[model samples]
Target: MKFILGLGKILTIAFWGVVLFNQLLPQPVPFNLLINAVGVTVLGLHILEVLFFNASLRGRSHRWFDRLQILLTGIFHVMSIPRQPQLPRNG
Candidate 1:
């Protein structure tokens, strides 16, 4: 499970990295849509992992806040999808 948790963290970082990179670099609409889809799916899986696997949060104080923070971060990443067209290929 630790490996799974670690993978989740890495994926979480990657989702945000793509978002910021896309912000800095121009990308196409379809690419943006694909990013959004993959990011949202990762976010959902992370949330499920935290909610179902992290038993510490179930009966502890501030549990809601911790989960909320994760949820909010996921939402932010999901909403930050890029909107510009990608650079065209040149011959």
Candidate 2:
């Protein structure tokens, strides 16, 4: 359980680190797209982490605060998505 939590925290930090580094460092368009793709992937991983924790909590060392945090983060994650923007086409 501790290991799982630690892994989750590391993944969360790594997601933010990539976002920060992408913003700070100059990069080619393709690299920028790659970073954006990674950001999306990390968000998905966070949701997965929350779900896994929810299931594993049943028979393991459990903390209400941790569960609450995971639930809230999951909610925020679901609510944060926006519809895709319309793209312009060449004439």
Best prediction by TM-score: 1
Name the best candidate (by lDDT).
1
Q: Candidate 1 at residue 20, lDDT?
A: 66
lDDT of 2 by residue, 1-91 (tens): 5556556656656666777788898468998888878777766766676777564445434446555555434434323333345589999
Please report, in order, the local distance difference test score of every candidate based on alpha carbons.
0.61, 0.59
Runs in model 1 lying further than 4 Å from the true structure: 1-12, 23-26, 57-91
Error of 2 at 30 (Å): 0.8
Candidate 2 residue pairs in clash (backbone atoms < 3 Å): none
* Cα RMSD, each candidate: 19.2, 16.4
Q: Per-residue lDDT for 1-91 in model 1, tens only?
A: 5555556656767767896677678479889778767767866876875666355445546766666656645433322322345589999
lDDT of 2: 0.59
Model 2 ranges off by over 4 Å = 1-12, 23-26, 58-91
TM-score to true structure, per model: 0.45, 0.43
